[model samples]
Target: MAERRPRREPRGLGWDGREFEVTVGPVAHGGHCVARHEGRVVFVRHSLPGERVVVRVTEDRHPGFCRADAVEVLEASPARVERPCPFSGPGKCGGCDWQHVDVAEQHRLKADVVREQLVRLGRLDAADPVVAGLVVEELPGGALRWRSRARFAVDRDGAPGLRRHRSHDVVVLPDCPITVEPAARAVLGRDWSGAGAVDVAVDSAGVVTTTRLDRRGRPTATRVLRPGADVPEEPAGRAERRAGGRDWEVEGTGFWQVHPAAADALVAAVGEFAQVRPGETVLDLYAGAGLFGGALAPAVGAEGRVVCVEADPGACAAADANLADLPQAEVWQGEVDAEGLGELLAELGSGPDVVVLDPPRAGAGRDVSRLLAGTGARAVVYVACDPASLGRDVAAFAEGGYRLAGVRGFDAFPMTQHVECVALLVSTAR
Candidate 1:
């Protein structure tokens, strides 16, 4: 006999199917703004602050609040705009949240959310000028077609699409304008039935490679697809990128900035903030493909030492090849937590003059920040993708006697709620 499947019990706050009009309040952290209906807190999406809208509750599983999407705007905000993507809506593609808002207003909303998260969760001062004057700057193309990389889910029917909000159901995406031309051509209108998912990336040379992952989540094959060509079945291997005035070769599936201008922008920002000089010892933690490490090598000069630590073996190998020109640069493979970082520092026998860490979305945790604080580095440049995680780690850094010196936000993922941040911290004892 087949094993019995466990039944799912109904869970809700008694407001699941409710519909009501709400006056949207300030923007919250996760692509939504807070509002109240009949004294019950509501988190509404697809709406802007100061707008009066009628919403349909999408989720009410949690106590005290229900999640909703604005169905009809009785009084629309000035920033409201016609959503460009047909897939974006109340129950459609969940990829782009702020597509309904004007591009400029989306920046403002993201900036507001970043500031609020830092101040509220990180306990950063609201009166701080840098925190208060935070703004999300756009890239070269403004907001359209900036993504050089995109991943799509494969539905049971073998169609490549994006998942719906809070769901595993794939929303068919025949076209996505936000992706770079190469990536857009690779997956859109393609049938990926043989794979569980597909990742498409466009290198600086404009070559688009698509990697199809099997149902077991292993890469079945990867191939370079010509514009409007069908997906190929052979591995194309590595791709080259030019950034920080140097050449970098990474695996077709490696972690590189998805935005066209992100690598240069971040390298410049970190250099300006950290100000690494000749003879300085620099540490690049979580250094993928040596983007930051390569940039710092020239600044630190022949007399200086630049060490790049990466947990991924493939990324470390890529970093090694990318920074081969710099005699002073070295790559160490390991995690970036207290134990891993501590052992590496001991091996170096001296502390770094400047440290740059670009950890994953779950920003370098408390233990990592605490370890970094004791390293005696004069400056630490942190590149964060999630504000909440950054805020939490910033608080942890404070406990290690480091202070938040400066932070800059970027609207890298336009139309989406994600924002990139580069933070500079200084040791109080330095």
Candidate 2:
């Protein structure tokens, strides 16, 4: 109890602009490669693994770690390629992450990220076949022009552009290479003097719809233009989409896959994993437009039951319409949290044979995953966009006695760090 030491103040302004040379380590989650500098971890963007580069610390708020950009490359990996988009670079448009990487290598890198997340966060064994043999399949469309739906931020002066990395500043662009030409043109081709942002989408029929939102993020105007038409046409109520051998109607710029080919690829993977039999009950949680429920309805037959639960009313309505022809399929609009899911399971009065969930980027949280696993469903098919979220949820499922069966990844969002994963978890008792 001798003399008390004076309180130490927190350090401020770390190596924010410090520059250093480092050998980049393996890629980590969130579109960055790991590197070390003086015992501090540096998350360097615009850099590939196993390369020597000079990194400029862009952010240094944390004491243990910092964020940087590879301003100069001393040694480049073979996977490095000339960045195709002029708007993309270390401090430019933050839309695409792997534009400088070769297309094939981009797929491989995504696969590596998926496996690493599962092993590191999910606590799965690295030697597990599902983790060891993972691969990111390339969609039909190449990396460019795959983005069919995008939101462009509008600056105060009314210029529309994508946001810079972790920044609110909009980088005005003539066109976004990753986005479909028509969709990009609809948003970037014109200026919205008063809008804060614009949402644009090109449907399967090539109808371009743009919705202008004010600074508060409220929709101010909506316009629809048919293909090859310069003038605005009557509002195209719901954009039409085709997936799983049928046409679907979704709200303009709604929750359909940004990549045109993603739906088909995901449907095939889900169907193959689900293998729903006749007279079985299936739950499609977070169902958007009843894509999976409607697709499985035919396989389940009239005796079987398919329930699609979604929180968004608009999406639920679209799901209802999409599944209208299939009497066996029904859409329920509600939250998919632990509490809501429990109520849903109780109302069903019977355990589902298979549970399919395509949660948002945040993934189905641990509570929801545990509750779903407790339902004793034979199979749980998880469609995840974020690897960290998937890993956390998978770990929660494991606690509920589910084992990792298999997983497949899709390069749905090429040129970007985002990768879509479809994983199958089966009960150990099964």
Candidate 3:
């Protein structure tokens, strides 16, 4: 006999599916606007600030706050516009949060979120010049078709698409407007009946590569398509990317910036803030493909040293290969944890003069932040994809005597709530 499936217990007094009118308030982190109905707070998506909309509660697991989508707009903000992507909207594709917002307004909203997160979580004063003067700069590409790399979820029937908002259900799509046309077509145009998802990327050379992953999220196969080629060629072990005035070798579908221009912009920002001088030592933690280390190696010169640390062996190998010509730069494969970082620092014999860390979305934890700050590095340039994570880590660094000196925001992921930030922190003791 077949095993019986467990039944889900209903949530009592829940607001799920309940509809109510709300006046949207300020933009909040995580791609939503805050609004209050009665005494409960609602995080409404697909709506702009200062707009009156009828929101449908999609989730109400928490007693104090619930997640909602604005189903009907009674009064629209000037920033509201027709969504460029037909796949976007309430209960539709959850990939983009600001599709309904104007492109310029989208940048402002992201800047607001970054500032708010820093002030609230980093314990920074709102009046601080760095916090008050923050702005989200736009990338070269327009709002649409800027995603150089993307992952499309494959449903059981084999259609590839993105997941719905906070849901496991896949919304099948013919194309994703925000994704590069070549990438979107490469994955969505094909049916992966057995694969759980497909990751596709278009490199700077116009080469398209697709990786098929099983339901367990393990890579099953990888195929490459050169420009103007009808069929995919044998799997190319690495993809070529040009950034920071150099070419980089990265694993296909690796952690390169989704925005084509993001790497160069970040490199410039990091370099300006780090201001590494000759004979200085620099540490690039979570260094993928040695992008920052290799870029800064010339500035440090042969008398200086640059160490690129990464946890992933694949990325480490790529970094090593990328920096082989730069004698001043070396790639060290290790986790950037508190304990590991401590050991690495001890082996260096001297603290780094400049530290550039491009941590993942979760950011370097408090322990890592404190450990890095203890190094007495003159400058710590942090590249963060999540503002809240950056804010929390900044707070931790403060405890170790570092002060946030400067910060710049980038709209690397347009049409989405995600924003990339480059921050500079200097030792207060200096």
Candidate 4:
């Protein structure tokens, strides 16, 4: 007689049609692993792939895929560590996913995630170079205090907190471990957000500006002056302190790289690859506070123009204020899509010599890809946050007539499994 399969049982995370005994095990990655009744498909998260656990039904449906949240662990994995945060285990903050797993394992899992995205979403050949990942053991300068900007929601009492992952409900945080030091200090010390956005920036002078606030999804032409870094003459200090490349204040509400040193390293890498020439025109897409613009303007000289494409009015204003001294530098207050870019480029008449794109996590679409391909620019430097997106766009560039020249990586968020990459490409000859 054939061996009998285990009997099926109901669980927490939902299952629509596919029914099987939920087997939990510790997977090689951090999360739990669950085997479905079919035995062919395995669901993984907080359980090891081999260990057994009773999974809660989160969502059920499709033929092969079912969503579940694990509730009970009948068997345990050796790798499991008692999670440190009350917000992470059993309870849910939803902000962090890998806190329960060992820190080293988190890196491995994140690497796998990136690798899978590259193969699955990017559609890269299996033989392509395996991109490596870095883990941040601690935030440099200080792990918990490195973040320079913070975006806090205003509750009714005028206190600030973060919204839930999917919902608008405010999560009142008595303590936020991930936020940078100065910004966190400014946030907790006072009642800043009054139904509006609040930003606290400390300039290089060690003075704090708590008054300038930014409200958009990203900090556009605006500044949030908090009780930190005070600007002498607003953004004008950037010109005055050009020797040290003075720090312009960024309010806690707007967008700025959480990791400052790492961002500097990445931008420096882009600068090195761009090999910008004086008297040449350049374009910065998705320019944030003109980090590229600020860095490249002097290299391009007063004669060269650095056109910035920024959608946020606040950021545009900030860019304008930051680059005010450069007569050749200008800001186009519009999106970086095909038509917008085309119009913005049309104003230049001639094609750009150097095109730098620091797109968000999603990466640029085909229209922008095609324009860069056909623009006849000598070189294009792309700075990307997500590796999968970078690889996809790199492949797209090859299809569009740009030959991939070289690529480099920067371990921006150490201890965390995030990597920042800069890629250089030269427009191929017709």
Candidate 5:
């Protein structure tokens, strides 16, 4: 029998503009391709695998893979499209990368990314089942209300905008399409004579809230929670309830997904997947401002318990006050890890039956997943911003006993590659 031959490596090239036939590597969340040049791994933008291309290295790294910006397209994939958004030009003022690709094809790329990450990094056990995004658009009801919270940097010329896709330079977007005109109006319309940062959020009800130092020089809590919506009885509750909006006040600009409806769908899906009973104890990992725990409290009825673990100080404070009315919920202020979870579980005196993990785009740490796997929890609902990381955590949970029970997609951001996903994993033994 002939011995197995070593796999040929990808052709690696330096900043040379030379052309090469390169297989399009897996598409990453941000629209970069993980390609092999010779043998080393390099991240290239605007370059798809299978179609050979000559690319220019915008960022050069020695001893480490460099980042390249595709300068020439020798071959193009059928999935590629002429990007419609003018903001996505080569200057890179826009944030989205898959705009040049068809919407359905974009989803296929995302699904592929999720699968590859789960297999290679997360150790996922996915096969024929396909994971795709929800049909829901970013702006449902014909209202662009998804961008609930945004921080527009105040430019030197008084223009409010986002930084260029890859550069620190700001783009003067007098009006942003992702946000409603009114919500964006306040940002673009506001006079930034003396302000350094302008924070804005818009509710689904078309109500806009602006938080920042007023021209009067005082910190303000502006809320557009709507006229009929019930305000939380407590002031702290007000922060949590209104925080999930276009202008949802972030705790000092920490990490958060921008889509309100998408987040709601994610949380609602998580609640359903976990199958929270009337008295089951649930652990909310990376619980920012008690959004999931607080929302789950009512869904689980009076007998349930939701222990929220959050590392952000500001978010935890809001979470504590938000769940103040719900005696069944508690916000544990700490990092998410095995030790922290163990101590929290010990305090409960009983293990949780439902687990909801909503980590950052980076996903959850393996230790916490391992610990949760060993517990009495029979099901886990993992919510993720980066499917790459989500797949990784899914693999970890699979190792612990949880099986990929169900998967759903949500279009939190339309006209962009970014989307949200929730995975339901149930214990195999149970």
Candidate 6:
């Protein structure tokens, strides 16, 4: 018998610079809805589900699917709305994917993506009641004026803007409504030749800091513009945030949620899911700026202990200072994978009763899940920014005797495809 050979992918059909009328299908994971034209699958952006639209294929000759943007909405869905931002359309600012979609409808689509990923990638059956009806709750004012952070791409002309979808060409943005007060006003309608990109972080106090990066993405300058102050060309460090009844000092370039309400909402969700009690050991892995640490420490009480492990030295340093008030909380300034959870657990001299996993966009890999399972934590809360990654990790956790007990998604990121999820997992062996 002849050995079976690997199937070869079909050669892509050229459809670039072409226009076609197509009916949009259900929302896919990447903020685009699926559609087909002449037996070829096309990923249509700037379109809503069930909308009949004319799409201009921007990319073809790709291995699996072609990319296109809605050139015209011939028949719009009831969920469609005039995009609030003029920069959000075909070939325009790629920063926002669903500006054309209604805010409520956007949450529905995101929830659909979450459910789909859990079913498909996580190998959870649709018949499983737990995986069937996922809902994405919107943070207070999630739709507009919620983004506390935005990084503007700089073009050759020195204008700070967003890049066009699938292109490096920057779209000059004059105004963006989704961003909170000063950062939006400071960044939009600005030009800077000194940097390839600019990072704008607005703290909880509404203080704006802009970091100018050179063409190589190195920070050349940092400046702070207090609220009501004129937008400075350069920016400086540390913005203070009050969350979980404590102050958090996060650096300008440090990792924090983009939405203004994300910190509070996530902290609440994590706290509720963790169910940490007095005198219980808690672990916060990939602890950025110790946001979860702040909440866990108080919940665990002085008798209990909270350990935060973070890799970014700058963020770790900031975490050290942020968690200083809570003597029960300890910060480990090293990689979670490199330091190894086993070593940390041994050093701490006990297993955690509750664990919070907030890894990067890539998600905590299988090795991390295995280690987490070995930790013997009764409860684990996982915070994720990407559904696909979360779904993959969910399966990994399953393999390690952890079952997804509950999941809640939040529209922390409004206009973009990104969604935040807080999942509760319980150890089956326990």
Write one digit per residue (lDDT tens) for candidate 6, span 241-307: 8776778899975688888778889999998899889999999999989999878888788899999
- Once fitted onto the true fold, the runs of candidate 5 whose alpha carbons sit more than 4 angstroms away are 1-26, 34-42, 47-54, 62-65, 71-82, 125-145, 154-158, 189-197, 210-257, 313-325
The numbered model that scores best in lDDT is 3
Report the number of clashing residue pairs per model.
Answer: 0, 0, 0, 64, 20, 5
lDDT at position 291, candidate 5: 72
- Model 3 C-alpha lDDT versus the unseen true structure: 0.95
Per-residue alpha-carbon lDDT of model 3 for 1-430, expressed as tens digits?
9999998654525888999999999999999999998888899999999999999999987778889999999999999999999999999999999999999999999999999999999999999999999999999989999999998999999999999999999999999999999999898857899999999999999999999999999999999999999999889779999999999999988989999999999999999999999999999999999999999999999999999999999999999999999999999999999899999999999999999999999999999999999999999999999999999999999999999999999999999999999999999999
Clashing pairs in 2: none
What is the TM-score of candidate 4? Answer: 0.71
**lDDT score for candidate 4 against the true structure:** 0.61
Q: Model 2 off-target regions past 4 Å? A: 1-13
lDDT of each: 0.88, 0.93, 0.95, 0.61, 0.66, 0.87
Clashing pairs in 3: none
List the candidate numbers ranked by TM-score, top first: 3, 2, 1, 6, 5, 4
- lDDT (tens digit, per residue) of candidate 1 on 270-355: 99998999999999999998899889898899999999999999899899898898999999999888888889989989989999
Count residue pairs with overlapping backbones in model 6: 5
Cα lDDT over the full model 5: 0.66
Model 5: residue 225 alpha-carbon error in angstroms: 12
TM-score of 2: 0.97
When summed lDDT is taken over every stretch of 10 residues in candidate 3, the lowest stretch is 7-16
lDDT of 2 at 53: 99
- Identify the superior model by lDDT, candidate 5 or candidate 6: 6
RMSD of each: 3.1, 3.4, 3.2, 8.6, 8.2, 3.7
